[model samples]
Target: MFQNSSFFQNFSTLGKEDTPKSQWIVEDTIANWWRPNFDPPRTLGKEDTPKSQWIVEDTIANWWRPNFDPPRYPYIPAHVTKPKEQTKLFLVQLPDKAYFAVPKNFKLVAAPLFELFDNSNGYGPLIASLPQNLSRFNFLYNPP
Candidate 1:
């Protein structure tokens, strides 16, 4: 299921007899995305640190790297850099009038149009929220 191209730089030489297995290491794909949480006696008590290839030594939330026994999934996004209070959080939902009185003239808004769907590739597009819309708020949409 994993992409080996991200795991090895010299992928062609890996199966050869002369190439040492240790050199098979390449830049981690996960590292390209989120920075991991690592802190020291040095700065701010929280810092995003690079995870070691071998998780047996460090406490990094890794899924495929460690080669650990009893597998572990990386904590689904721990915001090491951004805390909840420091974040500009907002809540968007259906209009209050919709719950109180369902309008016969109400239109249905699809969540997929807003790019709200589970992208795990495990299943088809999910999170298709059928929110009741008054069709009052028009949006500029560039459909995919």
Candidate 2:
């Protein structure tokens, strides 16, 4: 079971009200985004392959799967693994084509800022290197 928050967050918004379906669900949507060195349909070579059948199988074997020598991300006890109750954001679309959502109490007045990385391999890598700028947020939370 592949479990990663950032990995699934992208596709999570697809059927939501605020998401632009036309852009995401274009005719032959998979082909629109698929290309060599971008979204290749298969692994490069069987001769070059090692550890597992697919490249991701290696990742799961090393990181996600439990009971290895190094023990990467061991399964948390059920008591600790219980899901926390979280406020859900309701997507509200404006007539002017702006998207906004508010979770429980706080008001989100500003429009979302989307930062596109030219070198992003995927959301996993992109989110890992996020918040490129802290200066912009200094006004919001300043140390005394």
Candidate 3:
């Protein structure tokens, strides 16, 4: 529909010709736009760092998988050994948003779970009591 329009005719050859050149326009390979060396190398004519001054670095490949041929990390032993102690902690939440590491096969009853244990947070490193009749309550640690 816009074929006969005079507005389209004036701009018809926009990208058809070769780019107009100028000595001031810097090539991307020679100069990065973000660097201090971007603007014609600060009136020196030659670049700040010459081609002969540049170092050719051949970095060593240090990539190794967990169970691979090139052994950098320690190998996993065939047979795994068990710990001497038979203690396992059960994580529980208290009424006042404090965590209690309860032992496995622990009796979750009243006196020992709440009454027997001291309410103060100084008796021992371990804390107690999963709140009575626990409903929907969110208490999780997330980094800000």
Provide the overall lDDT of each model, using Cα atoms, as 2-decimal numbers.
0.24, 0.26, 0.25
Q: How accurate is candidate 3 locally (lDDT)?
A: 0.25
Superpose all Cα atoms of candidate 3 onto the true structure and report the RMSD in Å to 1 decimal. Answer: 31.2
Cα error of candidate 1 at position 34, Å: 25
For model 2, name the residue pairs that clash. none
lDDT of 2 by residue, 67-143 (tens): 22232232333453332221112222113232222223323222122442332343333232223422233333435
Candidate 1 lDDT, 96-124, residue by residue in tens = 23222212333223234334233323212
Model 1 collision count: 0
Clashes of each: 0, 0, 0
TM-score of each: 0.13, 0.16, 0.14
Question: Which should have the higher lDDT, number 1 or number 3?
Answer: 3
Please give the lDDT score at residue 52 for candidate 3: 16
Top candidate when judged by lDDT against the true structure: 2
Regarding TM-score, does 1 or 2 come out ahead? Answer: 2
Better-scoring candidate (TM-score), 2 or 3: 2
Q: Tell me the tens digit of each residue's lDDT in model 3 across 13-94.
A: 0001112222332233222321332122333564553321222122111111233333221223345242211111122222
